[model samples]
Target: MNNIEFKHLILTAKYFTKYEPIIDTKTDDIYAYEALSKFEIDNNLISTEDIFRHLHHNNKLFFELEKRNKQLQFESFTENKKLFLNFDADIFVSCEQQSYWELFLNNKKDDIVVEITENGSDDETSANIMRNFSSWLNNKNIETALDDFGQDGSMFSFYMMNGSKYIKIDKSFLRQIELNYNYMHYLKGILTTIRLNGQKSIIEGIETQRDYDLVKELGCDYMQGYFFEELMIIK
Candidate 1:
């Protein structure tokens, strides 16, 4: 299934998309639900990563697939909860101007946060594209989060024009924080800088009390991963 015959597979308006809650550690309530893509075929769940990687060589396929994912997510939206959608910087930059925003503006703009991955290439063109797009999102009362914001030296520079209300501390740094003072210290430094810049920090991959206590002591605004609850999927 890795090499999906995506061209042959009909891409519907609202395909198989899943929503996972990002819990607020302070309130112990869900702050928002992130839209994820998954394909279920013959009692098997196929991850979006399979499609994401396979279609990189075909720009048109990638954009259509991602657009379909976004449509499904918004179609399933409940007014009470904010929706967080992870977007591909490549497809985001290539799409028609304000295309998605036009679709979203008629909805509750404040209830949406568009998350762009930390792993995307930060070339001048990509930066320029996201910089403009992010500014537009901010003006529309939409927030942005730099997801997976560690394990890369370029992240700080990446956030200047890119940073919004949140910075998701990558799960890599969350691993073994108590056992490794090195990890703890680095985590502290990252959160400190992020706070100083007026962005809330989300400690990702907190699956144990140790992870919880440590971030709590350090004053992380949010936490996500198995420690709170395994991500819930509609299917």
Candidate 2:
């Protein structure tokens, strides 16, 4: 409920938070678990979207909830699978958030991918800051992945950013590619370009056998969606 205290909600999230597995299509191995926030309240499962929608009016509470999510995930993370955490590019500019993130990197120097989600904009300032922070994280063995590539204008702006080691192709681009010849070729070109750049590609939304085979042809480094849904390895 909107009336619930932020602290209490955070406590509630710890018991309900889950991680969804993202697989390596080439190896059939568990590459990482993308942390997803959830809370069971009153016999109903509350998702991260639901919590944020209700807390939209409260900025302080929103920030606190995010911090708690990271803390809980970090404390429980194992070494076997990489921990994938998503945040906007601007979040790293915060002194508090940066300190917290750095502490996590210090403890777990491997298998952590900080996914930069769709931020408000991709101006020089935010883009440059993220690039620099990504470099810092690289030196610490904490990799950065550009999430939702080409989903929107702001996200598309990040498509050419050379700092990321991993790039997640937006699902929208692949939704109808298998059915359209032109779309298929276009996607093939994109994947080829990514490979040429020496960055691994994670093609999202591979829901069918055709999709999987298609990406395999394109040399997709990773794949996720309903096709691999049954392969949930996060437990």
Candidate 3:
């Protein structure tokens, strides 16, 4: 889509934030919430991935929409829990933009974790950019989460993971475990390493009692997905 079309789409879209709770594995209480964006035009829902893919073409528009969406996410959330916000790697372009976010996120720093996500290629250059972005967030005293850990084609860097406060394992691992029971062993090893490094691990895609039981037994600090509750609109 051209800039004009993208601009019009943004103007006409009805945006909403759906918060999915991240449950503490032991107490089963909500430890945090991940704010997911939802968009609609003419009452028909639009794929967020599609919207972001288009947004990547223009960093200016990307950050503009990101600012609006994140503002709504923070405003609509009344719970006194940590909020995880996804930051795509491609948007970290200029120092001016970094300053704007640092100012914008000042008050909310204590209650937020900026999740580093890659919506595009995972080449070495992209990985370095992500590492730099994570460092910037860290210097600002904001916590960071390495999102989609171990996903295919997603960059997995020990340098980045070591600095992160949280490591969120990808949801596809559930399917991998189903295909090969030994994958659980591999996952358990990873979890052990995560614990050893003093970082918490969040396992996603827990959709059933069995899924919950297995991952909880395998030992994840937190669990998230459809098993506990679906995405909820607070207002």
Candidate 4:
């Protein structure tokens, strides 16, 4: 099926689900929101990477899909909670100011966090756009996060310079902490740098006791993944 057809099929399917907020134990606050999409056939979830790949290849199709997804999320969450909506940096950068910010303000300024995927845009242009977008959000007192930081060199640099209030470590890095000492050390240094710069570090993909222990030891500011709670459908 074509990209449009595929997105339409997924959106129309009744099996898609969204998870509840993942709270930070240390702060007792909801830190991140994850959206889980399930297929009706076998009750399988589509990976975040797959979703972004489809969006990258089919921009118009993804735009329409996201428009609907954002509306659903806005309807589901209360104004006291922040909704973490993942989107391509390019899509976010190109979003129409009135439509995007208006929807967010409708929910309240503090109740939205836009998590920009790490690999969504090319380096030079992406950096500039992210800087501009970050500044805009800062002006409006809206929170911005560099999602999946440490997945690549570009993402690391973007987090350091963009002045994002939160940095979400990629799940791949957390998954291998036990088997790879070097990687664990590398993540520690990254987390330290994030904290040193006055930003919060969120460890993603915590599916095991080891993952939880490591993040707790490192004093990660926030946590997300199956270990805490599976994504739940609000309805």
Each candidate's root-mean-square deviation in Å? 3.3, 3.2, 1.5, 3.5
Residue 57 CA displacement from its true place in model 4, Å: 4.0
Backbone collision count in every prediction?
Answer: 0, 0, 0, 1
lDDT of 4: 0.66
Candidate with the greatest lDDT versus the true structure:
3
Where does the lowest 10-residue lDDT sum fall in candidate 3?
Answer: 226-235
Candidate 4: residue 117 lDDT (0-100): 59
Tens digit of per-residue lDDT, candidate 2, span 1-235: 4456555855664345466677687886778777766766556777766766666556456667777777777666655778888864444566786787688667765667888764455677666766667666767677778887767575354433466788888777777664566787888787887889998889887788887787777778888777777755342
For candidate 3, give the lDDT of residue 76: 91
Task: Please report the TM-score between candidate 3 and the true structure.
Answer: 0.95
Error of 4 at 38 (Å): 4.5
List residue ranges in candidate 3 displaced over 4 A.
Answer: none
lDDT of 2 at 126: 62
Candidate 2 at residue 34, lDDT?
76
Quote the lDDT for 112 in model 1.
Answer: 77
Cα-based TM-score, every candidate: 0.81, 0.80, 0.95, 0.78
**Candidate 3 pairs with clashing backbones:** none
What is residue 217's positional error in candidate 4, in angstroms? 1.1
Q: Give the TM-score of candidate 1.
A: 0.81
Worst 10 residues of 2 by lDDT: 152-161
